[model samples]
Target: MSEALWQPSASVELLKQRSEIISKIRHFFYQRQVMEVDTPALSQACVSDIHLHSFCTTLSGPAAPKTMPLYLQTSPEFHMKRLLAAGSGCIYQIAKAFRNEEAGRYHNPEFTMLEWYRVGYNHFALMDEMEQLLELVLGCGSCERLSYRQAFERHLGFNPLEAEHVQFMVAAKELGVADLVAKEPERDTILQLLFSLGVEPHIAQQRPCFVYHFPASQAALAKISSTDPQVAERFELYYKGIELANGFHELTDAQEQAERFANDQAYRKVNGLAEAELDQRFLAGLAAGLPACAGVALGIDRLLMLAFGQTHIQQVQSFSIERA
Candidate 1:
């Protein structure tokens, strides 16, 4: 290994900037009367989402018959929701989150995540708050809100909501990722492919972007819009082509949450992927009734990258996995 491997990825100045930004975040939340909370990083179960690879560890103690798997959280969302269910009104956390499969320019296996929930706020209101928070953290910038369908039409000239499955196949062939087509991609997967390839790189850098109203099929923990039923009241914020945050109008129904978990497990099986155990405590919290709320998980590293005008997340992190 080279000497560079032992050094921090971030410069001293960048580290200072990161510290300052975190301070600013705390003060901002403090002024808003939002309580800062800490939750355990380890859990008995992990999310079943096929795309998320949670880091797992074995836990053994005097009360345990055998070692059982405990997963490093992908986000504080589940436990945070549990708190919300327990009447911890508005709360925020800046905590370390992990995923096993990520180590890249924009992703680190272990990174800081800034997540928060606001009771009685829908996703649209949360999107407004996201824009306001980014403005506070990154200095003022114009905010632009667009529906997911609008983004698809603007970038690729098609209505993703109304498109036939074959249309995505045609696009797949044209984009030169025919292997994706051969595997028979689902609706959301195809949209994600096209969006990541064609639109994400080209999203407006002139202003912060908040894209809302995703297809219901892609709504992880979001509530489907009762008004539309075809769309989820969710949003994602992007700045300078970098995704900063994902927010949702929280899903409260235990049965529906269980169904989504089952669907994710089924999808994992079909794709030959690992199936993680569901967080039953989290679902139980839902059954106990979570307040009508909205929550967002923001990538602190990504936001730091923007603050320092660095293109890669590593520049804002003390040490990326590559260096660690």
Candidate 2:
């Protein structure tokens, strides 16, 4: 083994800057009366999102009950929501999140996440606050905005929400990513490819842009928009084509949340992914009446990378996966 592999991935100077940035983030929330909160990094239940893979471990010892399985949280959103149900209003957390994904220029198996919820705020309001934070830390002006349909129309010359699966496939072929799209494509899957390949590169690369009102099928935890039943109240922020944050006008309906979880589990089963237990506690929190709110999870490392003009996520982390 090379001895140099043990050294930190980030320089001392970069780490110092990272600390200052974190401090600024905390202060930003503090001024807004958003309380800082903490939650355990491990849980008995993992996210049901098919796009994410959680790291799992088994407990073994005198206190363990026959090697019970535990999962490293992908984000603190679930526990934070429970706190919201318990009346912890307007809270935030800077947490360590784990995903069983490959380490890359923008990704690592473990990374920092800044997640927060604002009571009584919808997705748009949360977006306003998110942009304000970026302005404070990265010295950015007001962000650009686009709806999901507008983005597709402007760049791909079609409206994604109104397009059929076949249209998406055709777009994929034209974009030279037909093989990347599934042979028997799911509309959402094809749309994701189209956005990643065709649309994202063309949207607000010079500044932060919020693309919102996503198709209902891809809503995840967001509420279906009452104004447009075909779309959800969710939005994502991007800068320089790097996705920075995802926020939702949270779905407070316990039954609807359960159905979404079931749908995700079904997709996992069909795709041969590992099974994850449903987070009943989170659902119960919803049933107990969670406040109307919007929440977002931002990639701290990615934000810092953009702030410091670094190209790689490792440059901002004290140690990358290789060193860790």
Candidate 3:
């Protein structure tokens, strides 16, 4: 088959529906007094998440023909947090986020993200706000709240936290998911696999749910629960089994954050991934003082997909990589 002869496919009506949905999202947030903000898509540093791949580029400048490395942001989280630290109140951004090595029905190398922050709020408060936002945007009446432990218990009949490494391995084997757990012995990895394969599909069938209180080790940038050190103040909203957004109570402890970033760098080295440059500027913001805040990043394209009952991401995008 000739590549030129093949044409990209998507319904015009679906595209219009996507546009309406996006408009509704902006209006909803705007009504809530959330100020929309814009930041640069290119950055001097990339995210430290070992699992995510960032696209790198070089800027050609007249100053000595310098070639400094730049990256297309995977999420606007870092930059947005910097703004929040600077006293921007209740900010939101609808922006393009880029990632490498991703392309599928629900995955794209570049897609829109609806990221927002609420100053002086914790993860639980953010969860409530996200529920209302999803209800308004999707026109759903109500949503559910489920904890990570509850999800594991409800779906797999096991307490993820209490399960030993061997026990988790046994569970995976019984579930016929042994291959997925064999290479990674970490409890979080096994739990993640089971959640994706077993629990998520079931959750998607219900109304949108905010799964909160993640294990501390998986907190990423979220603050640890003061009442329960074992978990972090984090939540992820899921719909139709699709992960729509992730939110957290900001971790203001600069020293702990620095350690986490260093640990992430070490993990990257161990995994044979490129080490990302540390954004000292962002760290300096942390040192200068960051407000107690909560932030979330929603996959805008995925939200559009659920709203329009469309399964593929490329359908909603004007020019996907294949079309481009």
Strongest candidate by TM-score: 2
- The CA-based lDDT of model 1 is what? 0.88
**In terms of TM-score, which candidate is stronger, 1 or 3?**
1
Estimate TM-scores for all models. Answer: 0.95, 0.98, 0.94
Query: Across residues 136-194, which tens digit of lDDT does each residue of candidate 3 receive?
Result: 77887678888888988898787776777776777788778888788885677778888
What are the per-residue Cα lDDT tens digits for candidate 1 across 249-324?
Answer: 9999999999999998888888888887999999999999999999999999998888788988889989888887
Clashing pairs in 1: none
- Give all candidates' CA lDDT scores: 0.88, 0.92, 0.85
| Clashing residue pairs for model 2 | none
Model 1, residue 86: distance off in Å is 0.5
Per-residue lDDT for 168 in model 1? 74
lDDT of 2 by residue, 1-324 (tens): 899988899899989999999999999999999999999999999999999999889988987968888999999999999999999999999999999998899999999999999999999999999989999889989999999999999988888988876677788888987777747557787888789989889887778999999999999999999999999999999999799999999999999999999998899899898877888999999999999999999999999999899999999999999999
Model 3 clash pairs are 204-240, 204-241
